[model samples]
Target chain A: MQYTSPIREPLVLQGKTYADVTEDICRQVEAAPNPRWLGAMFLSLLALGWGSYTLYRTWWYGIGEWGLNKTVGWAWDITNFVWWVGIGHAGTLISAILLLFRQKWRTSINRAAEAMTIFAVLCAGSFILMHMGRPWLAHWALPLPNTYGSLWVNFNSPLVWDVFAISTYLTVSIVFWYMGLIPDLATIRERAKNPIARFIYGAMSFAWNGSAKTWARYEMVALVLAGLSTPLVLSVHTIVSFDFATSVIPGWHTTIFPPYFVAGAIFSGFAMVLTLMLITRHVYKLQAYITLEHIESMNKIILLTGSIVGIAYLTEFFIAWYSGVEYESYCFINRAFGPYWWAYWSMMTCNVISPQFFWFRSMRRNIYVTFALSIVVNIGMWFERFVIIVTSLHRDYVPSSWTMFWPTYVDVGDYIFSFGFFFTCFFLFAKFLPVINIAEVKAILKSSSAPSVIEKEEKVKAGVKLTPSYNPKSE
Target chain B: MTKHEETHKFLVGIFNDEDILIGAIKKLQAAGVKLHDAYTPYPVHHLDEYLGFKRSRLSKAAFLFGATGAILAATFQSYVMGIDWPMIIGGKDFIAPPSFVPVTFEFAVLCASLGMVATFLVSNGLLPWKKAVMFDPRSTDDKFVLAINLADNKKIEEAKIVELLKANGAEEVNTKEIKKK
Candidate 1:
């Protein structure tokens, strides 16, 4: 019965009991695919098809499929890789960081966010495969003893750290997401009338009998995993940043890259979560479960991280000038006023400026505005990576070697394909799994004032004579 | 805890509320009935203390696994860089531990996480494809159920236990024979 936040807006509206929560979630999985679900699936499949064709072309040809000259080796490929990786951060942060902080609000959205993280990492992994034309040799990145002269992976290389960081991140995220789903999967198993579904969910449930010892152990494991994931999340992005920071390139080699990239990752990540959650809430008719409070809280975080990213942007410029290195100073100067000034400015406008609107409570509450800004923030973040990679690499100290990097049809198609991959996986996830954490929502039913108000509404539906005490205008 | 092979007769008292379940457990324990287990949809806070279970040893296991992962990663890295294919890069020593730290740390976390989950599953007999008896399906959904092993006390009559459960606010009472594997 302890409500931590002053905002009494119930996370679960409709005086929902434990049974109601389970029924609502299980119905989403069990019900026939609605038109909206079908429409989304169609779109995702189209993207997947496009991506498959593009991959074939890239593999059939070579790295020369992209419009890469002497300069700008990594334009869209690394940009998409970093963008997807950044988008993956929000899920782990919501699940692990919020759990450690005892923020109960995370319970509603953590399941979907964790799923997003796994999917985003997969998208990032795909880019890595595509970036290496011969993805069959992808296993060479591992430290397996090779037959050729007993050569091993260079542990000192940041790329090696990347392989470990990304693979480990994906594994832990999957395990964490699956662990949280066990109880709910058991609920689905028991309720499922369909034999095939019953069989699949039954086996997946691991025969969870809901015994007291099992619940205790479940909580312990969740806590330990959360503890492990918190530091692991920080390290994943920090290691990712090392891919740039370890480089000798003028814009890439900076100590500020780690914290800067982490903040940017989180900022963009929350935006992506909001974008997806808004659609999910609307599509699934889960307004009571998702609520404006959850959305507003996420916005506040976006504002905070966005501002941090802004400060980092400014700090990077200041340091470049302060460093007194002609190359570094020119890199910063050329970024703002050079040929790719439009990309740099677009990043500044979308990532740094747009998130400032969230300071107003009304803006955060406005769904349309939130959704629009979420897309804008993602666009800005992608451009930020593009500006850093393309601009920095395009113009070097040796002017004769400098060239413009323009992505060909294959590059554009591949980027679109990753979106197709991300959404395709997401559509499948939404179709099968309980999008919300049912058990955690049930735990909060008592403390939330939502059910009392919701119960009154239900009475109204039942044609009771009770006067509705809930007032929207009073609040 | 009974062995996996043992067969036991159980009297299950089901309640909808956690408070009622906790109160029932206390009363049953006071009456000298050895409680077998309680099943709940979620982890009811303080239920472990009420059941008189000791603290879990999961943290100790995590520490052991984590240390093992760290040692393995560091040793693997050292053997590769220091002995197998020694080469000078960035003008630093080939066996530089600092440079190997990130991957080593990642490998440690990866191993520890997977190991902890494996340990939990094995300990709880919840590994994939494992089967255990379910007294009532409602326990995984909405109900709080307290199970008492009738085989623990031969003198305890079934009707007496049912009457006790009814008196203590049990919504439903049932008896079942469970075969553990």
Candidate 2:
């Protein structure tokens, strides 16, 4: 198993000190165009206000405002929920799971992805909470001791599972995100000049002297948490899948659900990572950090997962047709050519066909091309949930039960409102926290005193004699 | 020797190798000289234990602060929403558990985060306004330092300590004497 160590070819020669880099980052943010402020105002005022209006009407008018009725008891709301939840998955995958694998490339982008994870989850949860036409008393689903009016919440319920799954995932991700920030906080602490800056940074540094011992512990703890999160992340979305798999719906009850849902989630999530990153790179002026190499790597993942999800979609169809189950076949066919047929094909073309471009190295590396593809991936994923929910529910077994689900203004409004909630949180995170983990980036560029064979050989080739050279006693 | 002992002195040596610096520190520790403090641009493994530092008690304080926060949050919730107003929905019981989960969970997390933050500040004695040493900016990048405070006594044995630090791994050794500004 002997191998040569790479010669000290000067990895990232003339590396910037973390402090300088951080200050530069802060200055860049400070000096950036007022577009962020203006963007925030515009997105919030229009989207947030509209969303609030939709929510207000939903609360006042009840479930009637949505396209849901007896036939399609669950319509666009559930579709939106599943879609957003999948979209949230990419963040955890990039941050927690990738960290566990020790993928060095993830360091550059994980911060933003993790932040997006938190915000995306918030948005997803809002859709669900609002879906509860009675948004006020949404707690009846918890195992609280309520001695009156159906107080006993069934812990066994998948709905209960959803509550635990989403909440725990969110909590762990936030903690992981914050823990990762500590060293960067220390970096910021050192640069503080104003009293307020010093106070704030010093407080957050937690007496971190950057001692070797503390660093060891920090790395160990972070690794352990990453380990915990990797499986927890996989399980969280799988459990979310259980919310559907456990249901008695003909098309939804397939054995291939957990993996299918998980794949879809990652597919959507990576798309989201790309979307947010494209905007962030331009705004932050981080050409060096968020390089094309990174986008290409991510695009590869999107392609891999996109194909996986496409296969899942196809597998479901094959299974239905193979089993000769009329109801299931009808559901599958209706999805591709039903009232929501447009949404279905859109999902297929964008998600399945679009990522096919990444099979080429050139296309994958093209940032603009990937950015466009990632957006299409998101739209397709959104339609995936729509096709799954609307098509299946619209034309169930009973002919009289067949109906169309057209979202009222309230339903559409709530959709927009959730985006408002999402963007506002994101805008704030971008402002405060280092969007890229400053400390981690520095750790990646490291050197050791002991020269490897190649470095020694290179030095020898360069006729650079070692001063006071002494042979190794054993050698 | 007495004249040198009486002088506020420091032995400074510079080495580029970490192993030599570490070996020197170990030799000094073995010889029973106290290491006051050390600094590096980035963390070095085992530096704290080598210097005989204790584990941070920040976690314990955070737990205590978090407990206090949880209690207060619960009390406030019970008093205001549980008992005082008792707003029941969907024939829900007055003491519904589900309704309290969000608030209670929020309180626990909020408390833990805030407690850790405050304890982190207070334990470190990190006041906002202080002009401490900016002695060597290199301490923040690609340089290592060992500082022995001469607050209690004149640095008589500094030569031996400096020699050992240089032998073990120290790139540079320096000292500071508190002077009236």
Candidate 3:
């Protein structure tokens, strides 16, 4: 007999049947694009068009289009890179980490979140390519043999580590996401009335028949992938932190960088997930699946990670003073009181102070409050990266070369390009695929469905009769 | 019945509820019936064991692939940095093992996940163009399907098996003929 604790809230709320789960999730994919979706897609395409022009200028005219001096060389580009990469973390964390922990709420959000992870990583990677200036010689970062001696890529360099980490992270995430999509895609395939839809979904689904043997292997694969991804996700941001931590720069050099960056990544990632999911849940009418409980659960995570980030901020200040290094101490003081003090304060207020509002139960559950804070937290996160990259570089040991970094239109436009790219990909995914995982939801339906629904289903099962019907032509 | 004759014949039982399906499988198994396989829209817990399937070896394959990746990464890095044109850029030694850890970990995870998933898809005969041998299309939606091949159950009559399926709460019992490729 299936049993669940009475105290535990149902993950799949409302009286939803197995068939209803398929119908509800598949409705969006089967239907034509709504007006709201069309409008959003149009705006995204416009931004993308503008951003593409800036990207063209950056590529054609080179990094000179970006406002970069010798001292403040890596400004908006690296900051956006780190920001988008951080946002990518929430999807894998939700899909892999939460799956290992058996958080049932992850079921409703993992599909969309994984898609977000892929898109965000692509956006992050574009920054790296753009920052390379030549873009054509991007393959030089790889360890391929060339005529310039037999020199290989330095594995010791954290930048090189980033190449492996980011690529592996992206590849593994896509594989995991696609594996999960097979069963759901098969569901869509079986339900599709249009021959085009059927053939496309059928081909994508790899003709998955949902056999017992296949399900057993599928579960095993998911479990092993989760186990592998757990550490892989942690290692990704840690390697990203190494890009700064290994440097001799005062603010950039910190042993606490790994854990701090990881926490901040999750914090920002959760905020991004909320930003997308809140809008998605509303647009697609998926309130029954992506319930308030999922939002609140995600908020609790944001609160926890935000607090850790807040502590890391304080810890950095303490270490700077305690180290008794004049350069380090001056760096912290300059960040707080120097020319770019506004950026520092914005980071502190948004990343540290704003998430504390989730301490209250009402605030966590309030849709408008959560939505507003989600946007605020992301803005705060962007500021956090900006403060780290620009402030630290703008004022270093050499007072003669001290300079303030300013973003040109190209810098701003390139950032807007990522936004356009992320949203366009997301809107298309939301249109074409099942946003929520259908098979996993149905799997949990029996145990997690409401007690009333279970009773009703049980009664129906008892009264059901044998009705053998043959339809060979249906195949 | 001949092997060719029995290969095409199957006794198909459709179930709405998983509990009834599991119960029917138990009753069918206790009567010494040779069950072919069962299908469900979602994975039913312990159904593999009830159907007499061994635990999957995919985890072992993952470990093997992961180890291969780690060894390959370490060897390649060491061969390149230590032996192949070693140039000391920083003050660090020519062979730094600690620096190799990040790449090694990433490569291992990449190999393990990709390799395991590839193994799973290949083993399950899942491909983009492969025609799915579905006993009931509803098996991918809401139905629980229990399929028994007649070749493996020659001792039991087909009508008796159908009756047993009906008695055990199968919502629908039907005969399925598998067309030869």
Candidate 1 residues B41-131, lDDT tens each? 8778778878887777887787788889999999989999999899888888999999889888888888888999989988888865876
lDDT of 1 by residue, A350-460 (tens): 999999999999999888999999999999999999998899899987999988898998998899899998998898899899999988887776666454533554686
Model 2's DockQ? 0.12
Interface RMSD in Å per candidate, to 1 decimal? 1.3, 7.2, 1.0
- State the C-alpha lDDT per candidate: 0.88, 0.68, 0.91
Winner of 1 and 3 under DockQ: 3
The TM-score-based order of candidates, best leading, equals: 3, 1, 2
Error of 2 at A422 (Å): 1.8
**C-alpha TM-score for every candidate:** 0.96, 0.76, 0.96
Runs off by more than 4 Å, candidate 2 = A1-19, A28-37, A149-151, A447-475, B1-156, B159-181
Best by lDDT: 3
Give candidate 1 regions above 4 Å deviation. A1-8, A452-475, B1-7
Worst 10 residues of 3 chain A by lDDT: A466-475
- DockQ of each two-chain model: 0.71, 0.12, 0.79
Candidate 3, residue A282: Cα displacement in angstroms equals: 0.8
> Candidate 1, DockQ to 2 decimals?
0.71
Tens digits of per-residue lDDT for model 3 on A136-254?
99999998989988779998999999999999999998998999999999999988899999999999999899988899889999999999999999999999999999999989999
Quote the positional error of residue A126 for candidate 2 in Å: 0.7
Give the DockQ-based CAPRI class for model 2.
incorrect
Q: Which candidate ranks first by TM-score, i.e. highest?
A: 3
True contacts kept of each: 0.75, 0.10, 0.89
Indicate the residue-level lDDT of A214 in model 2.
52
